[model samples]
Target chain A: DAGVTQSPTHLIKTRGQQVTLRCSPKSGHDTVSWYQQALGQGPQFIFQYYEEEERQRGNFPDRFSGHQFPNYSSELNVNALLLGDSALYLCASNPTAFTYEQYFGPGTRLTVT
Target chain B: EDQVTQSPEALRLQEGESSSLNCSYTVSGLRGLFWYRQDPGKGPEFLFTLYSAGEEKEKERLKATLTKKESFLHITAPKPEDSATYLCAVRGTGGFKTIFGAGTRLFVKA
Candidate 1:
């Protein structure tokens, strides 16, 4: 079965610009979660979506938002990006909202200049 | 405050050398501990999960053990293929989010 897949493996954006990253969850999975990983740091949870609605969120600011479609695909959008926003954006999926294991995608590296 | 800390920011060993990575955590309520392996510029791959104290899980040459306060990933007879950053995370009591550690970078030289 195909695992979680993300689009535009790598991207470069300018400061003050907005960017949107896409993620397709693993087959048979329904819950999708977003995370941001800075260099040398572990991924910090951004938000989680289930049943096309956001169910949980992390400590990130309001500039970070996401949407999950009926097909269980997700999109992560960051507005007014700062250089600090440059990092690896990851997407994870689980079969259930309360599942113990989360399968992660390869992630998209966002570089802000 | 909830926090997860991993020891040994980086480690280098010979092909046959073995070592252990530590993950220390303190959360409001402990639900589970998770381990992941990540390569350069890639997302993490799940390794193992420990639900309770004194529990252990193994996959190939990698063995993971857990306690109430900390968890360990022991590598046996490591190989160059084992080179990657090992990350540890814990599921929060809320059941909605997870807390992650900074991770330990391991490099196996042949």
Candidate 2:
């Protein structure tokens, strides 16, 4: 089974612009989470989606939003992006029964110029 | 608030040398403690999960142990290929969020 897939492995956007990152969860997984990892730092949770609805969110600001399709694929959208938004955006999938067995995608590297 | 803190911001070891990374957490109630290994330019890979205090799990040269307040990832006889940043996270009770630590970077020189 495919572990997890993401689109546009790399992207660049100017400050104040908007960007969208995508992810397809692993097979048989119902929950998906997003994280932002700065260089030389661990990932920080952004939010989580389950059953096509946001189930939890982290300390991120209102500019960040997300959508999870019925198929469990997810998209992360950022509005009025800032230079601070530049980082590796990660997508992780987890099964309800196996909470700790999260599988992560390669991640989309977003660079805000 | 649930939080995880990993110690020894970075470590360098000769190949075959051993070391341990620490993760301490404070949560209302613990659901699971996780350890992940992340290579440069890649997302994290799952290493081990300790569900409760005194629980231990192993895979190859890596073993993870958990206590009520902290967890440890012990790498024995590490190799160059094992060099990576080790992250620790916690699953808390009554919440869907998983809090993560800053992580420890390990470099094993062959």
Candidate 3:
């Protein structure tokens, strides 16, 4: 069985540009969540998607958004990126909304220059 | 606000050393507590989940124990391969969002 997978393992963007990162959840999982991890820090929640709708969001600003396709794949979009936006983006999936256990992907490293 | 706090930003130990990492949390109602191990530049790998106080879970040489307000991840006879940043997180009964602590970086030297 395939585990969670993410696309574009690494990315470089200029300030004020936009970037899109993709994620495919682990097989048999339906709920997808995104997180941001800065260097030397634990991940911070970004948002969660279930049934193609965003269910919960963190304290991040509107510049960050995401989409979940029917196949349980997800995409995270960041607009007007700033240097602070540079971090590792992680995608996690669980079997259901009620399940707290999550499997995480390798993550996408975003570098905003 | 729900919060999670981990202690000892970093630790260094010799091989076969036994040590413990701490994670203290405060939330409305605890749904579950989680422990994860993360390698450099990689996403976190799930370790254990504790649902209630007094719950304990063991895997390999790592053991996790929970209390009303804190959790402990105890490593027994750790090796260099066990070195990584251990993260602690909590989910509340009110919502699906999980809060994570800053994590403790463990370095086991051979």
Candidate 4:
């Protein structure tokens, strides 16, 4: 009965570099979504994946991409990271895309230096 | 554009006091409104979800109520442990993307 789990509790990256963060969804969940939370701000939706296909995306640019495996795990990849990209990366999962009740992970602290 | 706005950027209350946080939202064809509690540097923890106006949900010392354009999270006899940033979010008929507000920071002092 493990909740959502994210890899690399913390990470550091240089400008223009690429970073990949991983997430394992809660058991019995089939859909996964990613969000970015800046300091003192609420999380902003990044994208969502269902059945190994990206179903929807937010206002993020092409630099932000994701992949969902058959096991329901997800990976968020940010390319050409900027200092502004420094934030808490959160992974959320639900039973389905329309479930609306999402369980979140502890989040990965990404610092783009 | 779908948007969510939470009021009183921050609030401070003494232990045993009661208060409420506000979340005003505007979305075309609303689907659901959600409340979450987030500790500093941590991801948000789901608190409650309201699907339609007049719907209410309660857990422990917290109660959440929803209206057509707004939602309220009422905390009763809050304690220091209740101190955290409360977030409001919504999902519309557009897609699975949930729009979030800036959040309200609550500090319950002992």
Candidate 5:
């Protein structure tokens, strides 16, 4: 069975531009959550998507948004990217929102220039 | 606010040596504590999950034990391959969001 997968292993974007990262959750999973891992720090939650709607969010600003499709795939979009936006974007998925065990993808490294 | 803190920003252990890493958390109505191993440039790999105090889980040379406020990951006779960043996270009764710690970087030298 395939695990969670993310697209565009790496990306480079300039300030004021927007970027979208994609994620396919693990098979048999339905909930997708996004996280940002800055250099030398642990990952911070961005938001979570369940039932094709955003269910919960973290302390992130409005510029960070996400979507969950019917197929359980997810996309994280960051608008007006800043230099600080450079980080590793990780996607985690679980069978349900209440499930504690989440499987993660390889992650997409976003480099804001 | 829910928070998690891991001790010893980094650790260096010689091959065949044994050591333990710590993860301390403060949250309301604890649901579960998770342990993950992350290699350089890779996402975290789930290691173990502890739901309550006095619970313990073991895999290979690693063992994880949980208490009310803390958890410990014990590595026995570690090898170079065991070198990686160990992350601890916690979930509360509020929602699905899991708060994570800064993580402990482990370097097992051969």
Candidate 6:
């Protein structure tokens, strides 16, 4: 009964660089969503993936994108990173699209230098 | 626009002190309100979920109650281990996105 898991506990990237963070949802979950938590602020929704397609997105710019594999794992890619991109990237998963209780993973800390 | 607002940016209390945190929300149609506890450098851990007005849920020393306009998380005899940021979120009907409030940071000193 493994819970949601994320890779690369921490990362450091320079401006104009690209980075990809990975996430494996809880065993029985099928929907994956990504969030960004800036310093001293709450987590903000980035986007959501289901059935290998992005279903809903937040106000984030086009530089942020995500994908969901068949196994329910997900990847969040950020391109042309800026200093403001430094934040904790969190992944949450729910059993279905309508489920309200989402299990979260220990997020990946991205440091944009 | 759907929005969630939490009060008291931060709070410090004695080990045995009791207090309550507030979360107020405005949305078109309420679906669920969620509570989560998050430590520094860690993701949020699910706490309780309230679906309708007057719904209440309890776990250990924490109790959550909901109403039409707001929710309250009551802490009883809190300990140092209870120190963490409590986040409140809301999901509205016809959407999967959960709008979160800037959490309330609690520090229980022993």
Best model number under DockQ: 5
lDDT: worst 10-residue window of model 6 chain B: B90-99
| lDDT tens readout by residue for model 5, B1-110 | 89999998999999999999999999898999999999999999999999999999999999999999999999999999999999999999988799999999999999
Instruction: Compose the digit string of candidate 2's lDDT tens values, residues B42-78.
Output: 9999888788888999999999998888788999999
Per-candidate local distance difference test? 0.93, 0.91, 0.96, 0.95, 0.95, 0.96
- Each model's RMSD to truth, in Å? 0.9, 1.1, 0.6, 0.8, 0.6, 0.7
Residue B93 accuracy (lDDT) in model 1 = 85
Q: Model 5, range A39-102, lDDT digits (tens) per residue?
A: 8899999999999999999999999998889999999999999999999999999988778888
DockQ per model, Cα: 0.83, 0.80, 0.86, 0.87, 0.89, 0.87
Give me the runs in candidate 6 sitting further than 4 Å from their true place: none
Question: On a 0 to 100 scale, what is the lDDT of residue A96 in model 6?
Answer: 90
In model 2, what is the error at residue B55, expressed in angstroms? 0.7
A105: Cα error in model 4, Å: 0.5
What fraction of the true Cα-Cα contacts (under 8 Å, chains A to B) does candidate 4 also have? Answer: 0.84
Give lDDT tens digits, candidate 1, residues A7-110. 89999999999999999999999999999999989999999999999988899999999999999999999999999999999999989887767889999999
- Judged by DockQ cut-offs, the docking class of candidate 4 is high
The residue-by-residue lDDT of candidate 4 on B20-107, one tens digit each, is 9999999988888999999998888999989999999999999999999999999999999999999999989987888999999999
lDDT of 2: 0.91
Regions of model 3 farther than 4 Å from truth: none
Instruction: State the number of backbone clashes in model 5.
Output: 0
lDDT of 6 by residue, A1-113 (tens): 99999999999999999999999999989999999999889999999999999999999999998889999999999999999999999999999977888999999999998
* Residue-wise C-alpha lDDT for candidate 3, range B1-110, written one tens digit per residue: 99999998999999998999999999999989999999998889999999999999999999999999999999999999999999999999777789999999999999
